[model samples]
Target: MLYLFQQILNGLHMSALYALLAFGYALTNGVVRRTNLAYGALFAFSGQTMILVAVFGWHVLWLTLPATVALGILAAFAYAALVGAILARSVFARLAIRTPNAIVVATHGVALMLMEIGRIASETRDFWLPPLLAWPVVFASQGDFRATLTVMQLINVGAILLVLISATIALERSRFGQRWRAVCDDPKAAAMCGVDVPAVFRHAVLAGGLAAALAGILTALHFGNVSFGTGLVFGLKILFVTAVGGYDSPPRAAAGAAIFGMAETLWSGYFPIEWRDAAVFLGLVALLVLRPGHEETRVAQP
Candidate 1:
């Protein structure tokens, strides 16, 4: 029973992570109709930038928890926006009129470049955050077993879910959301109707960048640090995870990613941890192959 309860807590953390990740990816891809694989690298890079800032005396400004969190969020978003802008200009620019596939292929190179930049910027130093909010909070207790989770876990999960919900609302009801969907359905038509296609693209990337930044920040805060080399693997995992959920809708994709996260956490809990990644990857691959979703089912126009 205790194990069951603990697994639920563990799954909650992972579910939040994957949900935010999927929403971030879908935010851009669903609207832009182009996959920016550099997104994962941007995510890692943003977190690295925040850590580098802290290591360089920014931590001195941590006068209070709210202050620290606000500064951290600002740092994350700043770096993400910087990277996103660069990618938008260099790799993602003019794709609608030029060649869409070129941009998709270019994102691979951009991802590698960002990873190298992150590695070089780190200077081979570890940027582990001093543990924050480490106190455990108990939920329920048995005679000898207690269901507990860390304060960081609760904060991370709550904050991520909140962002996800807020983004969903924005996408569904806001003017930008209306424009985003308009662009998604038909960019040429959207443009003809006064939707600034370029601006829409930029906004989508920035929105996605913010989402990725938040995810990276939370993961780093919870796990101590994220490796500079983790961007590719993280990107691939998120790519497949979001694929499982389909890219047509942000909310549905988030739900799918959440389900994958919970399943992964449970598998890790009951099985050999060493094989968990392999098993999860293989399972996701098998599912993707057997049932191709929106991206796969779409008939490309020539």
Candidate 2:
């Protein structure tokens, strides 16, 4: 029972991160109808930059605790937003409409370039960060064991909930939501009706990128280290989540992520950890083979 409770808590935190990351992918795909593979790169970039800022504060800037933490967070968000905007405008916006294969190749190139940059910057090594909030809260009790929630995990849940709920409400009630629906349903008609199709697409990518960045930072903090290879793993997991969730709905993405996190966590706990990812990949492949056209039928709407 204690093990079950602990796994459930862990699953919830992991699920939140996966949901946010997958939602970012879904957001971009909704607008341009193309997957921005570079999203994982952006996720890694934000996390790496956050770590770099902290390192600079400690070694180079000689800053106090508060200053270091603030600077690191600010740097993370600023870099994520700026790079997201620039990439959306320069790369995704221009190529997403031109050729399907072109955008895929271009985004993959962008992802590789970012990964290489991370490698060089970190001197071909992994980067670690001290947890911003390491305190844990007791949640459950059993014979000689207690379940606790770390501050970071609680923050992860809060952040995901706040962002997802606010975004959903805003998309449902605001003028921007109407514009987004207009574009998603039919870009040509939306443009004819005075909707800025390109601008909508750009916004979608930027929004998705920022969400991915936040997820990356939280995930790195949870794991206590950030690696260059983590981005690709995140991208692949979120890809599976988006596919299973049905790209048309963010809520469905969250649901899929919850299932994924629970299954992955339970599997790792019960089996050899080395085979965890292989199991997930095989499961994803099986799911794809079983339901090849599930996503095609569920149309996107406001």
List the candidates' TM-scores in order. Answer: 0.91, 0.93
lDDT of 2 by residue, 127-230 (tens): 67666688988898887798888998898899898998888887789888788777777777888888888778778778888898888778766775677767
Tens digits of lDDT, candidate 1, 2-45: 88889989999999998998898987786656666887887787
lDDT for model 1 comes to 0.79
Q: Rate the local accuracy (lDDT) of all candidates.
A: 0.79, 0.78
In TM-score terms, which candidate is top? 2
**What are the clashing pairs of model 1?**
none
Q: After best superposition, candidate 2 residue 77: deviation in angstroms?
A: 1.8
* Model 1: residue 55 alpha-carbon error in angstroms: 1.2
Assess candidate 2 and give its TM-score to the true structure: 0.93
